[model samples]
Target: MGICDAPARAKVLNMSQHNGSFGCNYCKIYAPFNEDLKCRVFVPTSNLQPRTTDEWKKLALAASNTKITRANEREFLGVKGWNQLLRLPYIDIVSFCPPDYMHSQLLGTVRLLLAYWLGGRSQLFKYNFHMVWHLPQVVRQYGPLITNSAFQLENWMGKIAKQIHESKIHIAEQAINKCSVISSTITNFYSNIDCFETEFIKYF
Candidate 1:
């Protein structure tokens, strides 16, 4: 049920970011960076198996236990380390989360296609038009994305941004910590609502 952009998804899952090898969450797809294209290109493969939550935990644990640096990396099965979310048994740490449509589709594919078509690169982009090609499959897997897209959640960013001081040191950390505190406070208040009502009755 986590709806987030690519970077946030990587942070929450403690996995490789979108640009890294084996960065995909749904499948074990290795996307290597194409220097000429200036982006990671996913080589289509049919035999790759979809990632499972159990497998994700195992891989994450194995990656964390090792003294793996750059040279000895086994791609870590796309997992860098364990996340707090993994500790929750009811949560599906893999497959349940899908990439945000706003970032992945509107900002990414649409912008790219627009740039190509409007910027007079349409002929050149014909060979590089795989972005739109995957839409149907993505829709099939995740359902109609407009409902769960990041559009609604992103509205809070403007308000949260205004809270930051001019110093701007650790801005993201400050925002996240503030959100966590707010969430904890709300949960605590609701959990103790009956006590509050009793105290209110006595006061009146």
Candidate 2:
């Protein structure tokens, strides 16, 4: 599943744990599975029964008392919620959520670039620059380079936005016209390949 780290790992799993604690949702060595563990939002897979608010609060209280050692803190934090989710038959939660390159890489990079050009030594610029500096290390933890990036999607959408602005057409009609223009252009380009070759040969 694609999700940000703080919400998925920290708030969900390590509730009440010190913010600086190095905890996570996945490692068995750190947070071993226990049947006795409680969760505020427990959902039984078989019956799909929902726990009462009071029961959830009790679970949360119990979970808060569960001792987490510094060494295995990360694994222990989110066991309750993680285990509960695992019992559900339909949803197969992956061990790790893929880092969002769209937000963290492409848009992040653009933000950094903008900060460099426009921020003019402001604190916001400094913060963005710092993040940009650490981006490579952050990406390395996730996996290989992203094959597709937000840059392409954002750029295409930006062009569409510009077209909409220039055309001053109704939004719905602009969308239809844009698609029609693109399809017609592609068809015409392919159909005129022989003509293009003839012109190329004559020009040469």
Candidate 1 lDDT over residue span 29-118, tens digit each: 667667777767776655656788988888889888986666655457678988888888898777556767788778776776787878
| Reference-based lDDT, each prediction | 0.66, 0.40
Best by lDDT: 1
Model 2 TM-score relative to the real fold:
0.28
| Model 2 stretches astray by more than 4 angstroms | 1-98, 106-144, 166-168, 181-204
Query: Which model scores highest in TM-score?
Result: 1
lDDT of 2 by residue, 77-167 (tens): 3333323443445543332333345664455546656666795532222212223433454444433334222343444556666657545
In model 2, the clashing pairs are 23-74, 24-74, 31-75, 31-76
Worst window of 10 by summed lDDT in candidate 1 = 122-131
TM for every model, in the order presented, reads 0.66, 0.28
